[model samples]
Target: MGNIVKSLESSLATGNLQKMSETMDQFEKQFVNMEVQAEFMESAMAGSTSLSTPEGE
Candidate 1:
């Protein structure tokens, strides 16, 4: 993420539209992947919590 931001800033400083666009695309893909992983983790945690709880309480 930091790398992507740095790349974007560098591209902007150098007036490289193509590099900026590519960096943005890469960032978007990484963002989407992170979201998916987060959702999966949340679901896995929820499942574990339920399994560990007492049957009646």
Candidate 2:
């Protein structure tokens, strides 16, 4: 009985670890994609004008 319980616990632990690892991987991928989008937006905003250009200087 004790051996069976131990085995079951170990299996559960392994499964949980695997799930956590997958979650972490997914989160990292999402974070990287977001970062890229942010960078693109930053660059775009830097050179963008608000349709208000002054007359010829």
Candidate 3:
């Protein structure tokens, strides 16, 4: 009986570790995508304003 309980506990611990690893991987991917989007918006705005400026007043 004691050995059976130990086996079950080990299995549960392994599963939990796997889930934590997968969650962190997904979080990293999402963070990188957000950073790219922010950079694109900043450059686009700068270009737009520069184009609209009047020439030689």
Candidate 4:
């Protein structure tokens, strides 16, 4: 996340849409990894506690 933020800041400083797009891809990758981890944690916790999420999600 910090890496993405720094990358985005640099891209903004240079006004580089290409770099910003690359940073967005990095951010998407981070989100994917996070979701995977969250799912794993929820799966692991399911046996002990009910997994919770916001309504409609």
Best by TM-score: 1
Candidates 2 and 4 compared by lDDT, better number: 4
Candidate 4 residue runs with Cα over 4 Å from true position: 49-57
Best by lDDT: 1
TM-score of each: 0.94, 0.59, 0.64, 0.77
Q: How much is 57 displaced in model 1, in angstroms?
A: 2.2
Clashing pairs in 4: none
CA-lDDT, candidates in order: 0.99, 0.65, 0.70, 0.90
When 3 and 4 are scored with lDDT, the better candidate is 4
Q: Sort the predicted structures by lDDT, highest score first.
A: 1, 4, 3, 2
State the displacement of the C-alpha of residue 49, model 4, in Å, after optimal TM-score superposition.
4.3
- lDDT string, candidate 3, 1-57, tens digits: 344355546656777766555555566776788899999999999899889988874
Predicted candidate 2 versus true structure: per-residue lDDT over 1-57, tens digit per residue: 354455546656787776555556666776799899999998777656433455552
Ranking by TM-score: 1, 4, 3, 2
Residues 1-57 of candidate 4 have per-residue lDDT tens digits of: 998999999999999999999999989999999999999998889845544654566
lDDT computed for candidate 2: 0.65
What's the TM for model 3? 0.64
lDDT accuracy of residue 34 in candidate 4: 100
Question: Lowest-scoring 10 consecutive residues by lDDT in candidate 2?
Answer: 48-57
Cα deviation of 18, candidate 2, in Å: 0.1
